[model samples]
Target: MRRDELLDAAEGLLCDQGSAALTLAAVADRAGVSKGGLLYHYGSKEALIKGMVERLIEDFDELVAAQPGETYTERYVGATMAAVRSGRLRRWAVVTSASGNLFLLAPLREAMTRWHREGLSEEPDPLASQIARLACEGLWDVASHDPGLNSEDDLQALEARLRALLASTA
Candidate 1:
């Protein structure tokens, strides 16, 4: 709980202020914890950013788990749509941009790689499924910055289209 609180503070700092302002002292102050207390949870800025990345992954996983879908592609689409609707993906874009550290993005990359593998395994038409996944992911990234594209109706339509593609391939 304390860890999450600290991470919450870090995320708030990242969102409210740019990465340049995300100092340990700033997070400690923002979290209402002593610097030592913050240190106890996260030793460095890198660790805190890493924690934020992990939290994002967990958030996405929860969305995926809650989605009712028969295949990984379906679940992925559902989760991405949820992320866009909830503005979580937009916040993630801010977090990733603020960090400016490729090393920190490794965990995100690894999770995506794993998800791609799982998505491929569940679909008989791997090419279609892969295309759907890529397209969905592309939309997810783009929607974070484009409100018109992220609207509920638009996202629903996009999901339907992706599902249709998958269905056609199957």
Candidate 2:
């Protein structure tokens, strides 16, 4: 299997067991590869973490690019909402914890900033986007950490409402 497949498996393991369960030996075992084989692909734990971050960023970039051509506000809202709805944010939290590297988020933050600056053609409403983004992020964080925050129906309704807000603003 490819390195990404290994990382994906590792991320799943992280979700299942948290940081305590994400040793390289564990990843290799889960991936059905020997420790030496895993080491061959990733010389060290740091290298493996870095590769996971790179893979995550690359996948995020692709997701952003896959959206239909629309206004900056629309695109951003759609992308962000897709992230929330798909439960990717929760999965990402698992990956983040396993990697134990905050720097991994830098590329994502930079990409978002660039998308905001270049995509919004009108009078840039930085505050609005920031608020919306934060709200969505809050929803994801809460959903990931607190299962009682919203029922499935409640979350779907909230997502619809958020999408409407984004559409109207866009």
Candidate 3:
């Protein structure tokens, strides 16, 4: 619970105040923990960022696991849509964290590679699954930068189209 609170504090800083404000002292202050406590969990800024990435991936994985779908592709698409709708902080972290440190991306890269591999493994048509997966990721990128670009209806339509495309190939 304390760990999660620290992570939440860190993300709050990242999302609300930008990456510059995400210092260990700031996170410790925001989390109402001592700097020592923060360090006990995350020894450095890089470690904290890596923890944040791991948490984000865990959160997304849980969402994907909980989703109801006939196939991994469907669950993945649903999870991607759900994430795009509610993952502004995550998107921001992914977009902004890399600039601070390239090493921060190693975990993200590994996770994405694994997800891409697993997301298409069960599909009848790997090409269609790949396209849908890429489209979903692209949609996430666009929505992260400009949420206003797609209305609720637009998102629903896009999901439906992607689902249809997946179903067609299935």
User: What residue runs in model 3 are displaced by over 4 Å at the alpha carbon?
Assistant: 88-99
- TM per candidate comes to 0.92, 0.77, 0.92
Model 3 CA RMSD to the hidden true structure, in angstroms? 1.7
- Better structure of 2 and 3 per TM-score: 3
Give per-residue CA lDDT, model 2, range 75-102, as digits (tens).
5556665676677776667766665466
Better of 2 and 3 by lDDT: 3
lDDT of 3 by residue, 7-29 (tens): 88888877777877878999999
Q: Model 1's lDDT to the true fold? A: 0.84
Write down the worst ten-residue block by lDDT for model 3: 89-98
Model 1 C-alpha lDDT per residue in residues 28-58, reported as the tens digit of each score = 9999999999989888988888888988888
RMSD of each: 1.5, 3.0, 1.7
Selected candidate, larger TM-score, 1 vs 2: 1
Error of 2 at 92 (Å): 0.9
lDDT order of candidates, top first: 1, 3, 2
